[model samples]
Target: MKIDAGNVNAVPSKRLFLSIIADYDLNRSICELIDNGLDVWTRAGRRQPIVIDVHLDPDEQSICVEDDAGGLPREDLGVIVGPGQSGSVATAHETIGIFGVGTKRAVVALAKQIVITTRYQHAETFQIGFDESWLNDEDWVLKVHQVDDLPVGTTRVELYQLRLLLDDDNIKMLRHHLSATYANFLTNPAVMIRLNTVPLEPRFFDNWAYPPEGSPQRWSGPMRTPSGKLLRVDVIAGLSKESSPATGDYGVYFYCNNRLVAPAMKSFEVGFTRGQAGLPHPKVSLTKVIVSLNGDADEMPWNSSKSDVSTKHHVFTALHDWLVTVVKHYATLSRTWEGQWPEKVFVYDDGDITFNEVDDFLTAKRAVLPNLPVVRPRLPVRITKANSGVAQAKPYVVGLYEGVVAARTLVKQDLSQRNWLAFNLLDVSLTGALKEYLVNDAGAELSSLDLAQLINRDRTVSADLRARVPLPDPLWTKVEQMGRLRHDLTFGRAAPKISDEQLAAADAIVSEVLARLFDVKLAA
Candidate 1:
């Protein structure tokens, strides 16, 4: 605890201690080297085709990353070799890096030494070397050697004395990690990445581009806020073409300069992804939201790592607050459009909803057939969470929210459009629920015009008919019991199921709802 600031010896710059190198794993180090090459390509704005080839040879006990991108300049070599100094490369698209420590940290984390071979255009090839033994002594300078073998306009990273060994599985994992981390980049035809001479294909997702079918369920042209800032919003919801894992892909992603900085993040305001911020997983898996910032580096929200957004930044915070609700409303629309209550809402007390005594007063309020004031029942409530879920491929959706309804296709592809279902959310004071199902399903799909007209006419008709969606006593009691049962289920307590008598009572309530809300009678 004593202060001894008198004499401090200089450690080999960029401090790569041999012992600390073991702290980082092999895959991460490999990713770091690859990210360096990627940053270079990003700075150039894809004017040239960038091809990065990674060579992982366990037998040789070395890892190499070579890219056809514009290599580091001679003046810039002093920074990477010495410390985590990012030279004057902080442009808008090029701002993903911070302090330029990723490659340095990853190199030191994986091995005791590294040799960087690079050339810029027709410039002479130069090599920079760092050794672990320098930590014990005073060897700060990395001798730069000119070499002729390295290709012109390229850079290669050769890692030796690796702390972690590489096998087939490790190599496979590295490939997968790269695919997920840079999936957005891979989506572009102009950008290509390879592992061991094989080109890695980007995982495709529905609505990634414009839909091949009718049109995007929801699309927003570029909109400018009051502050004169540009914003882009694109939204798609419902079942994936081949819904693989039920919770595979969902949620809104934030992209900076065509690169995904935060994948499927619930906005800071209303974020609901499974297991994060005390919100349950979304009931449906096919929902995907894309909110991107295409502006220059000044407006981007990315941190130094390029993996997260800086919530505290002034400019980004303003833009996010201004445009976040637009995306969230679209998300709500996506979930409610199809009207699957179990998939659309989550019941029980999560501090959002408070269930009071069952109000079965509707059945008594009206006394005739086709009773006007249809008291529509609202089931589970929807919540927003902030965290994201595990990543997935095939569907490019960045799965963030969980608890999505498992996809069970009645008909896989409704090519004729007749099989598609029509439903809309109607705001009703009944049950204090915002979701009101207009039509569950019919033989035909609702055309855009019909949908618009229905939406415009719903309030007028409901007001005129005096429709009140009332939860009958028995059904309301059943739902109330189910809500409590969910608590017991969460607490690992044994819960009992409703008997035939209870079910019959519930059925009677359902029939009443049908009669009052949609004017249909259930079979006996």
Candidate 2:
């Protein structure tokens, strides 16, 4: 064979790099190691009683983990603890330990030194000591010794110079986290995990059985991802009455592989109720939708922390779109159910509830109203120039004086109906030749109508009354501008005669319209 080398000193490419930089907490790292070890133990089909015992002494700053798995064989000890070597998942299957570096990296990352002792089923027992300096020292020897008698199948790892300890609270938290993280395994009688001396009790959500006789409306189905993988979705919809209460609780939850991924609806950045859709006095209890993506769905490109899904993944995009459609569909169903029931009669309770609570409740409730048209106050026809010369008919220029006056009247009416007469009123008086001429003529007709109805009628009224009405803009803008102005003030370039009282009244009318149509509180 002829050998030809173009670059003899070329370096081989590295396949993987350490993703985490900072030192991890010792207690947490130990837990992670145990979790990885358990995965390795279970996959080997050892079947022997497996146990993890942790001894923590804060004063000594040391922690130990002993597991009864088929302990490391004498020949495999070096490779098992070697850096960048993975024994788990050499075959195709969903083995929890994808990378073999978990235990080795975690111990080195958390503690100053680690000691390992193992007793194989039919091989001589051996012990090894590992330290940070050993990583770089090729000549450094590991303490390995053969023992005559040892536990049949046990591996013990002792971490010294620990950075932290597991207190009572932390132990409790660890128990909970372990139970949740290994829920499926915890249910298996073959696998047992204990924290300190206490055996962990796994509380799975699926264990909560439904009431037999009285069951909530529920829909359960399997959703297939673009890859043809199945994800389970289950929803428990509230009763029609429950769906639209004046104030109610409604929400959805996300799960992955039977694990609750996100527990609260607030985490989704969307409300549980229909208020998001602008319903007035909305009392819709949310239909609780619970979803569970399959375990294999981890390929969907979830973030490393698993807090959120990556939008770049097609599966995530499909899931997001599906959830949105579900929300909209349920909202429509809730509204339909609410409409079937009698209109809710509201009685203001001033005695029991605090004013703030009442205000907040009202504010939230008002966000659910259906959209309605707004009425603009009609301006009065004003004669700007009347009978300027003798023998001449009244040469009259129509002004918006009547419209301003009508707007004020409608505002006062709305205030009285809504019990908001205490609001501040700025006084404005109209002046200018047009106003004077209109006041002098005294033949203009101003009708008394709802402010909303009037606004709806005249929102399009331009400077030229005969011109077509412009499309109505957002109500909030109009209401805000009206509220900030001084009374009887002229707006726009044309100095039309307007009074402060009229402006205040117009503001009140706009506020009333918004409250009724959109459940928007314009006063504030």
Candidate 3:
């Protein structure tokens, strides 16, 4: 095995670039291009504003992303051609995209042919383009040339023959992701990002405030390790503007050398410290904590993509100790306030529509509400806001099965959901099964057995409240039919979660149905 080391590795795999791109989706792929542009802009000291424009055209099957940052310099031309080479090392520490493959990988993921044009302030304007058809060749060359129309201090990428359709849903998704991805930069007046012709505004975390204006800083300090290495941690804990899901931008942020490596994270999520030991309380989401960190690169642990921060560092352990002390005082009022209302009613919106307006719709064919997405549990709901712009919209008409089903009171449905039920009772691997009824031609997935027949079904909602919205007579018939079909599939019997293979197949089918739903929603 230890013979002469004369084996020479030559001719790198040409498909490596193309294959790595498969890991990124439309949103992530688009973010890669935007990140490169921002890096150059930040590297230039942010003295002037940078305007980013994205043009999407489905009919042409093309997309163009342009930015007014300092374009690629002639000296750094190898940055793109080389797989891991980076020019940002000498530039700003906060600049993103050090791997150098961002723009190339993203552009390749979207189109068969791509043209990249750039103009540095001092260097001549140049353009380079390549086609996917050349990916198989071991020695493919990019046709580079000087360009006259390209302006100085600008970088642009034109994509042709898109692999993914530039449809409306994807366009909206791009807009949403870009705004969130660059939320920190877009918050500044100097940076403007536009999708197609529309300007994108940075959406902030519903839980925490940024920069806090003149407000006193809640927490800021440097955590010292056994050695002299210093890990700086800064945090601000505050109330959210509105109630939102805990998963979104609602927690701490971690930055490595001024660039954000992790964002909107709760303390417990990243570490094994005492603060993370407790289960997340229902009120935990109301508190937004922006925890910014800065330290030597080697001291911090960022995943390869730089999207996640590891909790194994000593600084994280120290920060956890500090957070546990302060978390008790942060957003503790939400729980006390909720005690006044019934468990079904939680604080939401500025006082407009409540949950009742959304889930309380009339029964329709195949459980699909004509006015909304899909209804769950039961229905006869509608969501309408008031005409006055200043006043937030409240439930216009609180539809009541109005004492028809005994003395039960119905709970309200969240208004945020328009197309699908916001809450799922089967919040598990089977959650997607709830929506499978919409797309599966095999028939409704609902059980033939009545929900009331299920044990402790009343625990889902107050019976008096739930009984107010009677199960539509038509639904019971569907339940019966599905029950019979399921029984036949199992040889005249029913079993709880049949087989591992069946579970995997069910998951695959659900994924296909959701994909189709996306296609239908975005179809021209």
Best by lDDT: 3
lDDT of each: 0.50, 0.45, 0.52
Measured on C-alpha atoms, candidate 3 has an lDDT of 0.52
TM-score, candidate number 3? 0.57
What is candidate 2's lDDT per residue for 282-367, written digit by digit as tens? 52343444444543534333443333434566554545544544444445444433422222211111112111111111112112
lDDT of 3 by residue, 1-524 (tens): 67786877765676888878776677767777777777788778788899889898988988899998989987677676567766675322555676666666777788888888889975789888878667767774666788885766898889898888778888888787676667777778998889987889876553322212111134445655556666565565544554555455545566565445666665554321343323445554554555566555445556545566767655565455455434433433333333222232233222221111112111110111112112122211111121122112212111111111111111122333211121121122122223232224323334535322431222232343223333344443332333343345436454323343433333333233223322111010
Clashes of 1: 25
lDDT of 2: 0.45
Give lDDT tens digits, candidate 1, residues 1-524. Answer: 89777977655443444433444576556666766777777777668888888888889888888998788888888767556576425434544455465567777777767889988777888888877665445656667888875676799988888877888998888787577666777877777888888877665343332222212243334434334555443333323322222444655566665555665555444345332222323433344545545544544566655666787765445444334433343344334333432222221112211112212211122111111122223221221111111122211111111111011122222423212110000011111120233332222245656544533322132331122334445544443443343334335555333343443443344334433543332331
Candidate 2 regions off by >4 Å? Answer: 1-23, 26-28, 46-49, 78-84, 90-92, 136-150, 205-320, 323-524
Better of 1 and 2 by TM-score: 1
Error of 1 at 115 (Å): 1.1
